[model samples]
Target: MESSDTTVVRASQPPPVQHEFALRFTSTPRGARLARRLVSHRLDEWGYGYESPVNESLTLIAAELAANAVQHGQVPGRDFRLRLTATSGILRIEVTDTLTERVPPQSVPEVPGDAESGRGLLLVDRLATRWGTCPRSAGPGKTVWAELTDAAAW
Candidate 1:
């Protein structure tokens, strides 16, 4: 009887998949609050629950950006916009408002330790992997964006 040898080979597993989401809202205090809540809810739906660091970070980011848009970028009769997108490794947050002429200060000025204002972007800078602002394509508005790396696992 002839001896027979068999070789077994397995296919490589595919990489983990990623997803994206986006939203828009008005430029108002209520709108900002809604944006923050929606971000947390959406993260929960995406499997990053309230307890996840990613969800927490995203909530903070949404709150700060949306607040800035409403407080600094608001234009009468125009609405702001909030957008969130997530992939396997990255999550991006964007807030757009109607005041193109009034841009966020390039660097937040140093404030007295007890001052209650001027800390929103500072928090964003410290937490986001990358963040910046750009003029909107539709005209007369600006979009501020931040990205979080390792969003799925974080």
Candidate 2:
């Protein structure tokens, strides 16, 4: 009998999967509210349930950032943009507005016990794995971004 040789060939790995959602909203409170709602909806569609901690956290973060954009970054005739991207085990949320003058603090600020506001960024810092701000790539504004990592999403 002739000797037989065995060989193995490995398959190439497929590209990583990614999901993205982007939209522009008017620089108004109503628009901010809508941004929060749509963020939750999109995450749910991406397999993160409405009640999932990841989804809830992201929704809340979106609300905070959107509210900030509306209240602080509003430009008379310009709209704000919201973008959500999920890739591998990370989810990134970005809110861009047309007012570059206002930038979020680098560190969490202490809020007075009786303060009615100024707690949004604190909540975002707590809920998000990491967060920061940057100038918008294609416009005259800043983009506040937050990221959360959940292995379950992988």
Candidate 3:
């Protein structure tokens, strides 16, 4: 029997997650290396082993971003920050540096005929599902970020 009934369906939303790891390091070679190693250790603790492709790619991504922060975004007397976030099988890595300019390139840049470098972002682009840059949320700087799924595309 079809009576006058208007059934209202309410969609459910999952509870918010606050899983995040963050750190600050000086804009130096050692600092970039530390960021990379820490990312590997943290991902392993989070259930992704050292040999896991997801961990490998994420660590590389972190290294590249941190290196960029030190090489291109470095500002005198300013430090860089690394933030790792994991939620629902997604891992996000962000490296923020004191320079507001010098956004990370979306596509690979054309290298000179005799150049031996300038390919870090190309690696990041290929490994990450998505990557981009943004102004630092709490400082006068910029943050370059990349996201990877549990099954990373790398």
Clashes of each: 1, 0, 0
Compose the digit string of candidate 1's lDDT tens values, residues 1-154.
9998998888977444465566777777898999999899988998889988889988999899999998998888888888887756888888888788888777767667898898898898888988988999788889999999887566
The global C-alpha lDDT for each of the candidates, from Candidate 1 onward, is: 0.85, 0.94, 0.88
**Residue 56 displacement (Å), model 2:** 0.6
lDDT of 3 by residue, 1-154 (tens): 7779798998978535446789999899999999999999998887789998998999999999999999999999999999999877678999999898777766777667787888789889889989999898987889999998765333
- Whose lDDT is greatest here? 2
- Where in model 1 is the C-alpha error above 4 Å? 1-18
Report lDDT (Cα) of residue 86, candidate 3: 84
**Per-prediction TM-score to the true structure, in the order listed:** 0.83, 0.87, 0.84
Clashing pairs in 3: none
Model 2 spans > 4 angstroms off: 1-17, 151-154
TM value for model 3: 0.84
Task: Please state the error at residue 22 of candidate 3 in Å.
Answer: 0.5
**Clash pairs (backbone) in predicted model 1:** 27-80
Q: State how far residue 154 of model 3 sits from its true place (Å).
A: 8.6
